[model samples]
Target chain A: MNSRVVISNIVRWVLLFFVQVFLLRNIGFYNLSAPFIYVLFVLALPFGIPNLLLYILAFGTGIVMDAFYDTLGVHATACAVLAFVRISFISVTVNRDGFDEPEPSLSGMGFKWFVLYSLLCIFFHHLVVFFLEAFRLNEIGYTLVRCLLSCIFTLFLVLLAQFIFYKRKSR
Target chain B: MRNLWIFLNRYNAFFFLIIFFVAGIILTVRNNAYQRSVTLNSTNGLVGAAYEHLNVVKRYLNLGMVNDSLAKENALLKTEILALRSIDSAKDVTVKDTLRNVQYTYLPAKVIKNSFTLRNNIITINKGRLDGIEPDMAVISPQQGVIGLVRDVSDHLATIRSLLHKDTRISVAIKKNNALGSLIWGDRNFDIRKAFVTDIPNHVKMSVGDTIVTSGAGEFPIGVPVGRVRKTNVSTGDNFLAAEITLFNDFSNLQYVYVIKNKYAAEQKALELNSKNDE
Candidate 1:
């Protein structure tokens, strides 16, 4: 809620957006998988931000991302869903009694919590995004394989970002 | 009223979820014809401009490799120019096909984005509607082979469906026997650069090294180099021959290409379609 935290979060949002659009868009693994690392923005938000505020931020980020990727509302929808469901995972996994971390980054949430959180978050994100992109019931087999591969790819990038950039240890 | 306000505030995120899903469904389900908010289609200048600036920097990194390919293409064109000049100089005495009416014109473009590994690969070129490029225009690499077809056009950018795409089935023919067939990309590994010329009768005396070229009657002009037969096998039905051809154009190394606008394509297509309708 402080000005400095808000400013830094804004900076992180912009940085993640540009990196996803610029660097990651071109980095394809056999054209089958492109990492959706921008979701790290949603994953890294202050854990206590108002649910409505977080959802709006995630949805806005998704829309802008969809604009760049030319997928329309696809990213927004997935991001919105991710934001809404994010709290459910946190309550169950995080050691809430002892830890009072504001952000849910790998540094803040302990390694295990962050890993599971990112895998689940990216899994659903890619699942919705790719399946929506294909939008065919008959091609469910192809769509599922694409979703699984992309989920793994996006999860790897999101996890990598935490280790590389989240230099300070919260614990 | 107090209870209603509290519930609304408590479930605000859930409220937006429904809104976002509805908006998403509308955007995804509508085809371009029904789409009014079509800027989300990478054809928008906002997205195009960003990619353009990025490609400018990336294109610089590949300068050496691109220069080599440009030189090779230039040498090939120079020899062709010399051949054309000779024919022009001898035109008064010799009747030639070069004297035939010009049917197509070439527009130069650079490939800003090309994905070689995608099963249905799409390519982005730095020319678009503003540059007189349109969907269905034939795209070919500088060295003379099919690249793809212009699929969509923004103001200054266009996307091409690469020949490497699984859906591509271009009309091609064997050079020696002139047996017509269609060319396709990999059946097993979609990333494979080779193409297969399918539907030529089994009796056609084809062998390894037999050249395949665009039949010239369809999307491509006649006789542009396609590929040479690298391997042949009986197509699954056992009646037709299918040859694996090593493509002349390297999709991975592609940089510049020529987009061909056939002046008579519209008229010819109308005539052909009209005849088909009669049948």
Candidate 2:
């Protein structure tokens, strides 16, 4: 990645990290739905980014969140899953030769593609997060509900953020 | 060997995923001893400072309610002091209890960050090792009820494993007849205002509205309020009774808490260890 892209990604990580911890941490509805907007940073990484690097970035992001949540491994594990799924999903759907922009942002990828991408990634991430946090088989139903609700919440926040701040790249 | 090395390189990302996944599981499984990583929790200086600043605005919004509670507590303490003073002045009758000694001291601390939504909730308080706080010290609400135990300590901050956490099980007793049991959080629905009192002897009769308090078998002093029974039923597969309790403290909007320091804890622990050794 170029210097500009690298700097912008770092800035995005910092901003999303702060927003997730300071603003969204306590906003869960009845202890069920929590929006993990920080994962958007991982979801928005460029398709051309190296696979190993993406895994490291995702893990790093998750571990930082785990630190603040006092749940050291739960978030990290989930983020690692998100990175793996992202690599697999992108390879299946996106034709690299067709994209003009480096990153798979909202404006570059149409609404349908972007939504599907975020939905799948965030769903897997939230699934791992809730189930791992619960750490039980008996409470599978409760954990599933929490995971589904959180996935919807996180997906909505991610789309809102993309539409609000994402700019169309100039040729 | 060349083919094997090429295959490994081809799927290096998958291998890394497994490595990180296992590392994450190890961390989660070792959560019981997570306090060893004091630098990685909210009690860390950077995270604590941010939460402290955020709490400043949040605390301002709740000032009215906080003041009302403080006023109510002040009135109660004044009445208690007056009663004690009156008792002291009656020279004809001498009242002394050999069993009553100052055993617990309360160190007041502000809650910088608290979470009740998570299955395993933790509360970060402004006090830390510098303020003479340490792990396993009981934390209580300022309004007089159990909160949780101090789980980790840093230089200027600490994290409390709140009562709402699934792993928190406190020894408690029924107030009217002293039926002892253990206080535990929810099984399915992670309710913040309620917990379950389990393992009470089946022979003990329990009813709605009976008060529950700490059994003094743990870190908390005797008679610290825990909750009141909302419902009671016989547990299956065992001869123990369980009761649903409505907690006195609202774990959601906690502003300030007191970390209790047991003066005789070290002595008591040493004695217990000696006895165990003899056995």
Candidate 3:
């Protein structure tokens, strides 16, 4: 609720949006590669934020991306789905007491736990995204390749962002 | 009402999530209609502007390659002009000669984005409705080979359904024998098959290197090369020989293309429609 927290959230969203649109848009490694750093916006939200608010914010983030990429509603669909699943993911991975905090940091959750958590979330987001983008089951193999490659790239970017932003003292 | 408000507030995220998912489903179902909606497309004015800027940056990066293509095409055009002038000097040319020398116009445009790896590939070109380009216009490379046809046209951009697309079918024929056939993609590799040509006399001596050209029966002009025969085999069920043709123009490396605007297209279409009605 503090002004500093609000400012930091705004700054993070802006930075992620720029990285996604301007830098990552054309950075396809092969024809099927996808850079999905936009998920960082969802992952960085405070743990105790209302589920409803998180979903709204996630949906909004997706709409902004969809607008830039001209991908119709694919991004929004995937982001919203990921946001809805985040509560279950956090509850399963972290303790209820730990989930009551104002911020979700990799440091707070410890290194190995945060890596697994971020990787799982990234995998879910990428899987849903590639499937929706493909809109078919005929080329399941190709879709899997896309999902894996995108998930790996997204996880790398997410972890890098977490390492740079969240200080050791936050743990 | 107080309880309802509290419950709604508690589930507000879920409510929005459901609404957004429903919207996505509706958009997917009505994709065709949504694609044609000017308002929804134009609403992303900032995004569109950003893409336009990115296009400019990309154009600079691709300048050298584009200039090379332009120079090569210019040389071809020069030779064509000289040939035309020589033919004109011989004023005793017959009506048949004039028809044979019919020249097609070419429009130069950049391929902003192309989707060849997908099943139903659509290419976005920089030229569009404002540039006298319209839907159904046949696009070809500078070498006078078939590329695809324009499917949709906005003010500044047009999407071409590439020949590599599974759903794309072009009226093509054997250039040597004038045998009519349809050029269709196998939907796997760049390989295409010319189907429904069962009646070509076996004596015509079909070979792997035989050239295939547009039949001029449809929107495409005559003499525009489609591809060269890659493989030939007779159908098991029918007497028709299916020939796999390798496309000369690579859809992946497409940079500049020409949009053929037939002056007599409207008249030809109307006459064909009338004949169909009579039948």
Candidate 4:
């Protein structure tokens, strides 16, 4: 990867961490729901990034968030699972679009596909995080409702950012 | 080897995911209170919670002079209260309140770490051998209510098997009739501080609000408040009564507790052991 791309990625990482811990941490519906738009950084990586590197990056992001939130390992575990899913997701869906080199973003992938991918990734991450934190068989229903609201909120924020940042692409 | 490497490469991501996923899981679950109560005797936390609590302990240690003075004052007040209670008991003709000798001495200790969520919850107290605390010593709340007993000891720390532990069975008796039973934390919910007193004969009448007290069993002293009875029923197998009691001290917010060391415990234990050996 070029120095420019690496610098941008690093910048995105720090920016997302700061935003997640500071701005978005408290912005939730009631006390239970919050958007984790920092997931955008993971979702925006190049489609061809190494699987091993992705896991490491996800773990690092999660650890930083865990430190800030004091949730310890919750975010890191969720991010690692998300990174694992993203690998297969990109390979099967985005790579088939005939682009020589692809970035996993709204402009790079078509609108419908990007929406579906973001929804799936955010839903999976939120569901894992909420259920893992609850960890009780009786609280499964409560955790499901919490996971669903947080997933939709996070996906909405991620898509909004994509629309604002990315320029119009040829159909 | 070349073919093996190629085949391995084909499934490398899945295998790697399994490894990293396990690592990630350990990171998350290990720090959580639910996992700590099951695995450790409040012995461990992730590196961060450990360090964060180390600072808290350091601050608590610095309050030594104040705590010492307060404890001394409390001991004096307790002796006065015990004398006053004896005088009051003489006035009541029907009530039979027992008086205890000063055989068990109390040592003040702060709970450095605690968990109430798991089946076998353990509490780490700041007192150990150096502080005259030993395994099997009864732990009581500030109000002289039963909490649990010391299980394991290190040089400067001890783990108390809280009343919430599944295996804990402190011998107790109903306040109304000195009928014997043992207190067991049979409930799955830790949030509700409750326990069951089992093995009392079906003939012993028990009500919902009856007080239960320690029967001066193997380790615990007599008359320490166990809990108040909540419900009663008989299991199908036996004709004995099972009385659920709501514990007095909230285990969730426990901070400081008194460890009671029995002066005559060694002699009592030896006599009991000799009897068993003879039998």
Which candidate tops DockQ?
4
User: Least accurate stretch of 10 residues (summed lDDT) in model 2 chain A?
Assistant: A162-171
What order do you get sorting by lDDT, best first? 2, 4, 1, 3
lDDT of 1 by residue, B1-279 (tens): 999999987667668778877776666556323234543553586778998899999989999787767755764574455345434343354555555445566677878998888678899998889988878888888886799788999999999998978787789989998999898885775655688888888778888999899897876777778888998884657678788888888898888878877767888899999999999
Q: TM-score of each candidate?
A: 0.44, 0.45, 0.44, 0.46
How far out, in Å, is residue A127 in model 4? 1.7
Pick by lDDT: which candidate is best? 2
Candidate 3 on B131-186: residue-level lDDT in tens?
88878888887655788899999999999998777777788889988887777775
Question: lDDT tens string, model 4, A1-171?
Answer: 477778978898888778788899878787568789888999887766777888888878888887887777888888887887777677677544566555777776678989988888888888778867776557787888889988888888898888877755533
Worst 10 residues of 3 chain A by lDDT: A96-105
Which docking band does candidate 2 fall into? acceptable
TM-score computed on alpha carbons, candidate 3: 0.44
Model 4 off-target regions past 4 Å? A96-98, A168-171, B38-279
Worst 10-residue stretch by lDDT in candidate 3 chain B? Answer: B190-199
**Candidate 1 local distance difference test against the native:** 0.79
Off by over 4 Å in 3: A97-100, A168-171, B1-17, B28-279
In angstroms, the error of model 2 at B232 is 22
In candidate 4, which residue pairs clash? Answer: none
DockQ of each: 0.24, 0.28, 0.21, 0.32
